[model samples]
Target: MNPVRKRRFILVSALVVGAATVIGLVLLGLRENINMFYLPSQVNSGEAPRDRSIRAGGMVLEKSWQRDELVSTFVLTDRQGSEFTVRYEGILPDLFREGQGVIVEGAIGADGVLAAREVLAKHDENYMPPELADMHLERPK
Candidate 1:
């Protein structure tokens, strides 16, 4: 065929292939992200993603929290009081207190529970503090 026609055909094919390649890579990257955000109950029930990164959220069980001086061993519990003991070797967030909220990101073990690579303790809100939440919650508005 004509050189102009051949060149245009090649350009179109290249653009289509390039777009497909970019979409494929983005989909691959999102595969791990898709398996994210599970509740503690879900985690305990074996619903967490072991092959990818995930976020596990729940209420820190009161009285179930224990910090080991020798190690950073601790337990996190759900709203139902179900507890999952976690072993982390790093400085925990200042907001990581008992009965507070937390959302951990990592992988789940074959034995169950998360083998967390990153732990994020959630507080009441950006403005509200735990003490304030407690005061407001304890006393009626």
Candidate 2:
């Protein structure tokens, strides 16, 4: 092979290899940070990874909430009857209540409990703000 052609081939090969390496590194970084969402049933069935961070959302089970000072524990359940316990060590949101929808983020333990790092309250479409609750709106016929 000619010297110039060999040099050009080497340069192109190096550029391709460098680009691949960079793309691989970026994917690996993202994989670690990605938090996947799962249903209570899925988590209970062991479909979710025990070591990775994940999100599970469902209605807060009635009479399942128990608190101990700064720590709160509750059960989340879906309509299919699958339920899981979650433990969090922070003040819950004001909107949190029994039968309300909530999403918890954290890792699942070997005992099947989710060690939550964050809790988010979810409201339905008909939910009205406290300030607007008392105000009546006139509808156009």
How big is the RMSD of model 2? 7.9
Residue runs of model 2 more than 4 Å from their true location after superposition: 1-36, 128-141
TM-score of each: 0.56, 0.64
Where model 1 places Cα greater than 4 Å from the true spot, the runs are: 1-36, 51-53, 126-141
Residue-by-residue lDDT tens digits, candidate 2, 1-141: 899999999999999999999999998989845644677888888877798788888999989999999899999999688999999999899999898999999998888889999999988889677667556344333
- What's model 2's overall lDDT? 0.88
Clashing residue pairs, candidate 1?
none
Error of 2 at 36 (Å): 6.3
Instruction: State the lDDT of candidate 1 residue by residue for 41-132, as single tens digits.
Output: 76677666566767777776667655677345456767575557665656778888776888777676665656667778876645777899
Structure candidate 2, residue pairs in collision:
none
- Which model scores highest in lDDT? 2
